[model samples]
Target: MRRFFAIGLLAIHLFNIAGYSLVFQYFIYQTDTNLITKLDLNQYRESELIQFKIPISVPYIADRPDYERVDGQVEIKGVLYTYVKRKIERDTIYLQCLPNRVTQRLSKARNAYTKHVNDLPQSKKNQTGSTIKKSGIFSEYDFKTLDYQFAAPLATASTYISYLSPSPVPGALEVPGKPPENRG
Candidate 1:
């Protein structure tokens, strides 16, 4: 009897663990999350920056986003994010995000970069070079006057006009004693 009781207790415990595991899995699947880790952006290589495009219902933020200046913590569907600049086009959304603490460092780097660029001496725009005027036969020809328009087939224009025209109303024209043609 004791052995049976022990087996029963073990079975109960196993079932409880399984139930909890299933519930946790469900919770994870239901949650909408974006994990912004340090590997997302490399300060040395600007091209390696990670961009997240999420399709969700959000208010129109901006058409052209200035990611550097925009600073805020956004809570999107219960998920918290920092330094995320959003651009919503139609139904889709583009998210540019950076880690919370890294924002200051990025700003500092940007300032230093701009200062360094400004300090550099400006190079002379026009450099004198030896030039030889060409006297080729083709040089006298006026290439701009030549027509480059594509010569489309006459049938294509007719087909396009037909497509643009409104479709005929069904049964709009009925002949006497003839079963109405199903134009549709």
Candidate 2:
């Protein structure tokens, strides 16, 4: 009787372990499938929309008074604004219309550009005048245009840069207050 009871208890414990393992695996699989489904949905939504292809090439410049120029080809539907560069590579995409928030930001950038231009000495301004004219960085209407040029001195113009779609930063959704609950 004692031997039978011991064996029965051992068997029950083994069975419990097996059951727990199967449940845990199912939970993990469900979580993975949920994540994959969410990603697929997001991709489908983005692919269904139209986006403009804009090529941008920004040069790296050291500290200097010279205005760094960015050159790019901006494509809006069939309209194309081409620029001269060693190579043209499509870098970003934009929607047909600008968001209200983006418009506000662009206005701020325009103001900053005006201030910078006003501060420039006459000689430096003269040298950059033609490039700026050709580049159209200071044009009020041009700045409002959805497309942009890739030029040198990109660091200063980082704020003005916009992406076709805002990418979610990795690990951004993690709970900051606590680690995940351990089922074990």
**lDDT (Cα, tens digit) per residue for candidate 2, span 20-75:** 44454465455445534543454234333333444445554232333222233343
Highest TM-score model number = 1
> What lDDT, from 0 to 1, does candidate 1 have?
0.47
- The digit string of per-residue lDDT tens for model 1 on 1-184 reads 9999999999888755454444544443332122233223433234433466877665654544434423345545534445435565666666665434333344334334433434532332234543223232345466676667887678644333323435476436555796778988
Off by over 4 Å in 1: 1-45, 58-69, 74-81, 101-184
Candidate 2 yields a Cα-based lDDT of 0.42
TM-score of predicted model 1?
A: 0.21
Query: Which residue pairs in candidate 2 collide?
Result: 59-152, 69-151, 69-152, 70-150, 70-151, 71-150
